[model samples]
Target: MELFARSEKTRVVEEIGGVARLGELVRELGGRRVLLVTDPGIVAAGHVERGEAALRAAGLVVERFADVHENPTTADVARGLAVARDFGPDLLVGFGGGSPIDVAKGVNFRVSCGGEMSDYRGRATATASLLPLVAVPTTAGTGTEVQSFALIADAATHQKMACGDPSAAPKIALLDAELTLTLPPFVTACTGLDAIGHAVESAVTKPRTTVSAHYARAAFEVLAANFPRVVDVPTDLAARAGMLRGAALAGLAIEHSMLGAAHSLANPLTVRHALPHGQAVGTMLPYVVRFNATLEPATRQTYAALARSGGFADAHAPDEQATEALATVLIRFLRLAGLPVDLKPLGLDERALRALAGEAAEQWTAQFNPTPVDPSAFERLLNSAS
Candidate 1:
């Protein structure tokens, strides 16, 4: 395993109201033509108008592409690409949640590199210089603002693709808690739970490193302590700040170590059931945790420490006991966020488990799981969750 790694750090300007400084930050990139890519919901929230106001105030020529859809497909990327072509932007600003941000990167790939999304599925496939992106995340999930990889699905097949490149990473991440304040309660729960999944999965991946371990542990701590506060009181600015920080750290952790079985498992569920990403991931996380913990003594200890760091386990508990407690707490998180903990409620019975397992075993992140996960193993986990 390669133990050495480095990240192209995104310049983070985090504050209670940092979006107001977005134009100033992007001006540092020296681009006069800016195309802001976002979704209608964020437009409805008025964050796009605020971002436009800031960019225009800084003497930049701004164009808007605000029709992004959830789980952005190549179709969404192509639409944004057509807008990018017509507008000819020197800079791209992703001004919403993960979907919009991923679309911006997908558009960047096409407009800069001149190929389909499949052409850039793996890491560092882009051979052309890409436009700089300023990501202003409106949700405390996916942490797309801090990541180089864009999770775009295929328009026809519905397969989610993880396209990564060193240059595709955001140049600046403007995290404003005020921007996240308008996320409705269910959106809050779904996104926050996804961040929690990022923290948990990255901590114990087979390739996890010292640097990733630092990010994973810190992310888990902050996300664990703050997820409930934001869930209970949507207007709690302090909790939103903590969640934003935690999600960013989780994104960095994912950059270094990647994700694990939980994310892999979630993808198939999301594709098949149209379950929200976070809800699908959160529902199966505890089962994946239990499956991973028992694979090796070292991995068990690692999960135990991660759980203890989040105060979900006793300091002196046995590794297995602590890991069990961790799994239980993960289940508790799903419930706290008003998300489902199993597949039963969605009306999928045991018959649906076999095919889902096959698809899950094929996910890109599945290879990085500490335990070598085969379809049978995934089937077992799915059966357990069901």
Candidate 2:
């Protein structure tokens, strides 16, 4: 049976002093022993300290797990599990970008479900109850805060595993623009682009529904308008809040609609070339948009609608021309963010492209792409991007 389950129950707290409300959330969730999962980078940025302080101020016992790294592997989850086991936490706090949030979910999965990460690589596989989680994002990307999916790679093979379960969704998403104000310019650009990619891809994916499209459209408009401002003026609280809210909405869209080829293509680049996830997706998005719009009428219309939301498409233009205009606009955002527009700049050659294309074809998200993509088709797409 086909299912269309949307996570509208994840309470979102969006305000300038939103992190201050964490104390109330902790009390309401009845959390006595809490586990805070984060990375060293977030700790250095002082966001982790602020989060810990919030929990401590709530008079809750807090345990810290700061061993998570970028593109977290299963080993990272095991490390977190070790801490969780010792802490016996009733609530888990994911305190950073996608990596820490995903790591927190991974640890919770094993702690509650009693298995290795490989046991739950696909969707709706978990039968065990998951611990309540609160997501505090310091970066305005990855929408992991609002989605139930966790991207944990294999420690040995570096192949990413997308684990999803209805129970894995965060119980609350705390969006405080103040936390994002300290983001470096490069991170702001990369994460902002990642949010935009999520909105764009989710709008045209196979599972897109009317509700999902609404969230995606709102995400696209807000991110498109405020991304440059947030990147250029990091201290602009309004722009930062717009990006944070937009990213959360994109995440909600992903929960309902899932993602498509860009994410599938981006994963291989991150695993093979150690490219940043946002950078990989952002660079390849324009090409993917063009590829899908050319081959699918529904996707072309969706792209045209998204372009109209951003004021980039002509209402009277042909679908192909409108979609092309959308792609051109995406390319402009990538260039403005100081990201490469092609794979060659990342030191990838034609030989490497063939291997990456094969991996991209096998990725689970590729099946959800509007247009079917085989290894040969991926090669063509890669060649175009090159």
Candidate 3:
């Protein structure tokens, strides 16, 4: 089924300090036992303690799985699954960033359905109903909370596997923008860029629908207005709120409309260069935009609409002019965020670039690009960026 068409009883609540109300929410969902999944960073940040207090105060049993790493792998999921089995929780609370939230979902899939993550690659593959999940995201990036996909990687090969199912989508997304205030500037920049890339890429994918486009445009408008503010001044609460809401909206876009070449291209760079996902996507996005703009007039028109949505160009501007405007603005964002805009600075050579291009072509998202992409198109994009 199409993602937005699914009839899950999902709830989204926006509260500035909603983590403190987790206990109340869990009770409303009929959760007597809770497994709280998170990484060590969030524990150190003290968000976990507050959530634990709330759940405990509400008289719920809770367990902790705190070993998730960035780009969580199969090993990470297996380790988390062990904790879930020991606790036998009736519900899950994913209390950190995307990694922990995804780890929680991964654990739920295996524990409830009795299989590895690969068995549930596409939508609605779960053999049993998964545990109810309440996601309290601590960062403004990744946007995995609102979507059903769990982006776990293979431990040996580092190939990202997007495991998705309708039953695996979060039952509640509890937003509290104040939790984002403690992030370091670089984490803030990288995650914010990831959200921005989601808005831009989902706007023009081949299967984009009217509902998804509405979310993409709304996400782009808010992200474009707030990203720079948060990057330049991390303590700006208003900008932080805008970013959190924008990321969630973008997550909804990716839910209904899968992403495009930028995400497909970004994954290879991340696995090969050990680059952060946001930095990889940010560096390659402008080049992909320029490459896609030449595909056809309709694609060019879509890019133009995105440019106008960001206030980077006038509504009446020609498609070619607005397309370039969007590409230029993307590069400017790289400069503003202090991220590399090309592959040369990363020390990747022609051979390495060629290998990455080949891997990029095999990614699931590549086929969703409005223009059909092969290794040759990816090679051209990488070479130009380099």
Candidate 4:
């Protein structure tokens, strides 16, 4: 076995009605002046107002930055940093989905450390101390609240950049399913699949460790078991809570083990076709799984275990059989959730596919996949997805 460094740390402050407790937590953190990073959609959904009320109720000063986009760009981060600096916030609050949380992480790094985003492009690049951050997720996907990395897009090129550092991790993550009840069924379905993708990608990455595998497997089980249930019964609180927990666990797993080609490919699809991240990634995952399973029998077995643990059929089957069965299950799930199943269906043509595959092959995450992936393999995968 290879000796490796492990930095394990996560603090999730969870409750059935976390919104009601937000005021107390803010007061305890001694955050008199705070920067709240979010999007307009969240404001429209009333999450922003609710969070604002809670913070103000705690006798804290709040400055809002709600201009974040879906695939947050460098400009978005810059704008957010300006807000943070102008407000001189002692603490930061990330409210909403992954984009807002990711934006907040970027703001923390740039404001406190003073550097270009590209300077901290790779993993663990933070050399400066950062202010405390609290994350409140309104959606159940991306698990960005628990991660030390932020995925920000380049403003001009629209290319996603993965910036990571231990200092970027939030001090507290508040998980409350009540906030997710307003999510549309399709958004719920898409984000749930994103959680599944994170778990699967983590399980088979080259640096996969025992701890990452444990979290990834557990996340997969929860996502697989609860995703369809939530899609079928969107108001089921128990199922929503399960999906939220799964997303958080998946985030933790990816924070340690990183991810694989599915995300690598999915990023370009979002940049090129303007498809939602989760929908694009969900479409590419089945093909990536089948491709990876061809070279890694043990990985396939692990996936089989995940499927069985989630109560999916064919768990006891042979590795190849189980892999295929899992693929089928995923396809069915996507269909049931009303998501696109192929690149063509998502308005991606062969010309776009060729370009996207080439770009995906160059992504940093591709280097960490358990099985080697080249441009030719990526082209083949794209074709299969189409």
How close is every model to the real structure, measured as TM-score? Answer: 0.96, 0.95, 0.96, 0.94
Local distance difference test, candidate 4:
0.85
The whole-model lDDT of each prediction reads 0.89, 0.88, 0.88, 0.85
Candidate 4 lDDT tens digits, 1-386: 11111344447876767887777787777778889999999999988888899888888899999999987889999999888878899899999999999999999889988988877787788878887889999888898888888989888877678898887888788888988999998899889989999998999899988888888988888888888899999999989888888899899888879889998898888777787888877888899989998888877887777667666655457767777777888888889898778877666677877898899999888999888998888999998977
Which is the leading candidate under lDDT?
Answer: 1
Per-residue lDDT over 84-179 for candidate 1, one digit per residue giving the tens place of the 0 to 100 score: 999999999998999999999999999999988999999988989999998999999998898889999899988778898989999988889999
Off by over 4 Å in 2: 1-7
- Cα misplacement distance, residue 201 of candidate 2 (Å): 0.8
Clash pairs for candidate 3? none
Cα error, residue 325 of model 4, in Å, equals 2.1
Candidate 3 backbone clash number = 0
Q: Which portions of model 3 miss their true places by more than 4 Å?
A: 1-9
Which ten residues in a row are the worst by lDDT in model 4?
1-10
lDDT of prediction 3: 0.88
Per-residue lDDT value at 96 in model 1? 92
Runs in model 4 with CA error above 4 Å? Answer: 1-8, 346-350
* lDDT of the structure predicted as candidate 1: 0.89
Q: What is the lDDT of residue 378 in candidate 3?
A: 94
